[model samples]
Target: MKIKGLKQLSRTLEKAGQSGFRTEAAKWLEQTGTDFLDLVRDEIVRAGSIDTGSLLRSFKRGAEGNIWEIEKGGLTLEVGTELEYASFVNDGHWTGGKEEVRWIPGQWHSGRFQYDPGSSSGMVLKRQWVKGTGYWEHAFYIFERLFEKRLNERLQTWLNSL
Candidate 1:
């Protein structure tokens, strides 16, 4: 498995025993709150007879990112959520924290995650967008950015009491 930030959030999230913001975020993202976490959670798509690259491009990544081949039929998605990243427990919750693109405890940390499903192998590719900080919650980072622009406009109008 590939592990990014071997010393920080990466390690924390992987731990079966929870701790800190990483653990909290996981719980929050799974079964609580408001934001659509499922859309941003780590994803693993089996080849499923479809062309993996084409399938990801069309249905998953939109138009960017590349695919890494693992085994005969296993393929890895450059983007997607790990189940632990955001458990089904909390699907629509707000991942609260400071810093944009930070490694919050509950959310999945950002990095260059790689998966080799054939061998049941995967690793966090978390290279922080910010400097100095180690691994941060990744799922939250993806959650905020993916939906922030849309939410802001809606919230502004709703809060106006129109």
Candidate 2:
């Protein structure tokens, strides 16, 4: 929420080298997101308070980034690669919704999502508004490596912890 001690953590991560940062981010993903999918599914099937036809909210992770959504609504969450490159798309699908992208400078000032893998990662979601078709985009990304893919690979680690 407050990102409590983010400044301190970031400093320490940078000092320890890129691998340390990845390990830390991966840990965050494992602790927060892994079971969210299952929990939502359970709520839909049993609570009956959620729409079951399609996910009311969905999450996607890759080596480049991560995304969060609420079907037919607005963007809810996002996390991008290690370079701070982000594309947070909220509301509807990209068809008409807007996206917020965060840009991070990587090793040699590169913006590649997976070339280095040691410099960047995060996400953002853009939301849409009814007035004048306005859209709100939230973004957090790192442009160093293919973060989304890495996120996917590490899912099992999260599951194991669960």
Q: Against the true structure, whose TM-score is highest?
A: 2
Candidate 1: segments with Cα more than 4 A from true spot: 1-35, 40-138
Which run of 10 residues does model 2 get worst, by summed lDDT?
Answer: 132-141
Worst window of 10 by summed lDDT in candidate 1: 127-136
What lDDT tens digits, residue by residue, belong to model 2 across residues 1-72? 588878976765466564344455545555444445344334334424333333323323442233432222
lDDT of 1 by residue, 1-162 (tens): 977767665554444234333433343333222233233223212212122433223223223332222222222123332324222222332333333343322232375443434543443334332221111244455556755675565445433432
Residue 48 alpha-carbon offset, candidate 1, angstroms: 11
lDDT at 63 for candidate 2?
27
Runs in model 2 with CA error above 4 Å?
Answer: 1-19, 49-52, 56-162
